[model samples]
Target: MHVESALRTQPRAAEGERVETAERVDAVERAGLARSVEHTMAATSTVLQDFLDGRVRAAAARSDVAARLWADLADGVGGKLMRPRLAVAAYLGIRGGHGDDDSAAIAPVAAAIEVLHTAMLVHDDLLDHDEVRRGRPNVAGATRARLVGRGLKERTLADQVQAAGLLAGDLAIASAFALVASAPADPAALLRVVRLLAEGIETTVVGELLDVTGALSSPRDVDALAVAELKTAAYSGSMPLVVGAVLAGADDAQVARLGAVGSALGVAFQLADDDLGVFGDPAVTGKSVLSDLREGKRTELLRRAYAMADDAGCALLDAHVGRADLDEEGAAAVRRVLVASGALDAVRELTRATGLRARELAVDGVPEPLGGYLVGVVDDLVGRGH
Candidate 1:
């Protein structure tokens, strides 16, 4: 989507009053978003638990497997609830208020989008071989723990755990579709939601494939950006807004504008995340600070570092990046090179630019309160420390 020039023409508020007013507005919007997220989370929990209970009762003979799958899926819930919140925000943006009837109508679809996100995260953990998420055992990790407690042989346990994780991801995907199908929306709107969900899955899979290819073979800057747009932007960012707007009967133009805003927001979010992957504290991020360097993940940060580095810096990067045995000292050396080459500053600047673009798009045509909230979200996302 093209960026609207008119967005830049909007008048800015005066300095001190603007700051005070913006803070007050942000606080109010944050409180509203928090309440919406809480409602969505409660509804999502009810839907998932009810589904799990019915499935377990129906498959009594295989109750253990059913329960395990539900546990895995449940573990993926209750994080920031970003997707559902975005959906609710977009819905409110279009509908003008969060009345009881509007909330009742929106919660089911919001829950569906959250469920869809959980499904993708389950699969993503498997793909990334991440054993922990949110500082707890992920699906694969939990499965491995269960199998290990059973005294299974190492090889057999690994195989069984992988299978369990795969099946849990599959169940989550199927349940996502089921949730959307049962949402209380018009038949035509439901059709659009279904199409959006299908497209999200397809786009994410293609992006994942590109990510794998980048890691293994190419790892170009363009490829890295493409992966971010397809994998993170489309499903995690744009689709939620689109779904909510469609449910609120938004016409095609509004939907398109929201999609563009979401895309820019998503890209900025990922860029900030890339910065964290390299420079953030492990305690705050709930991850090893060196994991990205160890894996040589194809992020724009790394791509820029490579391009800007001199021969000695390039040699340092080549020697340590992606090395499985890389130690703390090696990672430190790589970080030094990145800083010396100005890659970190370059990426930070890009992230700020992207956030500005998203803010501009939100102000262009998206209604007030929602537009203001969207800008607040961009600020919060790009400013995240973890």
Candidate 2:
């Protein structure tokens, strides 16, 4: 899902050795991909700005709140743009290679994916009571900050801010559909894109429901994997790839193959993220390493750890896993138990196997240049250090 990392240039061949034509071609494609990512970001900004401007003009009396909300949503746009990049990559891959005309044609679709991502993140943050994302204050956090500045008490401030965050998420979801619906593509393709987007959204909602239920009740590995597939895999990975391929008129077989590839890669990405949430460096990941353990997120990692642990280890887990006041010492204890139980290794192996499957699918289904790029994406996402 870290699309930017995948697009980075690898080291050049030894100075004395000549580069092959394939390598040179790959270089060009990589540059095009980087530029396309930038293009998508800019186009997304334009779409958001135009929409916000229209809203402001239509209701001058509410313009202040509207503008503030727009700013909050806009601040959320500068992520890695993974979903949008996936859409563009799929389109270009299916179309043979990058073309300016094609890139222009797919820009709206790419922008819509990013808009939808923003909406999901806003809602996710509200659900998690998380105040930050990508190293910045999230919509809910910013709303709370603004209200606090106006001298509202804590309870009232939290209520108002949460409501505002909900509305912001709703706006983003509505705008995402509008962008895709209005994209200037073939009428049939546009309809397919809309349907795909709706399916992705619905699946994610179901996944969220499962996640909440699992967290409150029993957290099983099977249930966790299901959540990953429906929540992160469908929306973050498969939808963008499938949507892009659909736009390019890919055949059903090809579309299905790419969806499988995307789902595998997405599940791998989430599993790796679960590892990082507990073990990655805070400075590098831009989030607290203890957050997941403190919250007892019931990820596959935790479930595995619990399953593998002895009675004493289980006792330790029970003592501190979900403690709201879980400090560094408590987290360290849980970490020790997790490592001793070999759960981390199990999760890592699962991620590696899943990533390998995704690579296989990409190599078999997608053509060269694009296939290689997607393979690299899976590699970067699965093996990322942070």
Candidate 3:
């Protein structure tokens, strides 16, 4: 699902010349995306830092609550601000406005996205029973740490930690809604954005439930890929882009186009991510080796592999898939079976098709500078490891 592989089956400019031309095009797109993300991150960081600082200071008298929220915001905001920044960048691209006030207006909204994302992480960790995140303790892990520090007994500690993490996640979700409502934009647009964000979250939650339920049930008829699109793609990709378009005063057509692009790209991104999760280098992905395999979570790739497998292949997978006791060699063997079953190639083809649709959906009446920049953003996201 890497960028190169994602476009493998698509029409090319020409076999020999296409490589040279594509390389140049890809390089420019990558640079533009990097620049845009860099600028957006700078602005987002300032807003997030300021917001957290204010929150901490306001809660100064309430040390316990303030400290918990502060830790959540600080840790959550520091990671890539890609989602909210996408909204702001899209706004700027469409409106061609960059005044100080305009820039300031986006911070809270962007910060809201971070808040929402962190809340989702808190929930996701709870669902997956993950022990680590962003190379550190997640909300659940952090709560457990606090409980241990308090010298709570084992069962008491576990219950308290779980409860605290769940509540913290709920607070983060609430804060995100509050931040969006507080954005200094057109009141109507702010309300619309808030509503859309809530709907997107709900949609994603439904998809997540389906995914977890499917994993525990029979594998047949499970469209895990579609679930990935609905859950991860809808919120992570579409919502941010749509929010940006709304902020920019984009017409209905433009906003809809951005959403379509977001949806397609989001799916591609998630598929690639799933691939990397199991097969990627730990050094590069910043997670434990074969974490996804060890976790026994069902991904589109896994479902497809299982479906496409021969009798012997199915036997091999049945013996290994979702076995927490699997060793390193066992995981590698499963991967080999997946590749041999041609599931990887099929999924890769779907990724390419979706990416092309995304490119088509992305083309709209946006200003040239902004449009080019946005396209670059799409390219970099679908093409790179990050």
Off by over 4 Å in 2: 1-62, 149-154, 220-222
lDDT at 69 for candidate 2? 81
lDDT of 3 by residue, 1-386 (tens): 68876587455645757889766775665456446655665777777677767776766767866677567545654576668867777777666665556666666787788888888888788888774788888777777776687767889987876776687788778878877777778988888888888988998899888888887764546787778888888888889888887876889988887787788878988887777777667787665657777776677788888889898988888788778788889888888888999988887777777776777666564444555666766677666654
The pairs that clash in candidate 2 are none
Per-candidate clashes, comma-separated: 0, 0, 0
Over the stretch 297-351, how does candidate 1's per-residue lDDT look in tens digits?
A: 8899988888998999988898999988889999999999989999999999999
With a 3 Å backbone cut-off (N, CA, C), the pairs that clash in candidate 3 are none
Q: At residue 91, what lDDT does model 1 achieve?
A: 85
How high a TM-score does candidate 2 get? 0.87
Candidates in order have lDDT scores of 0.81, 0.83, 0.75
The Cα RMSD in angstroms, rounded to one decimal, for candidate 3 relative to the true structure is 8.0
Cα-lDDT of candidate 1: 0.81
Candidate 2 residue lDDT tens string, 215-261: 77644344688889988999999999999999989999989998999
lDDT of candidate 3 vs native? Answer: 0.75
Which regions of candidate 1 are displaced past 4 Å?
A: 1-62, 149-151, 218-222
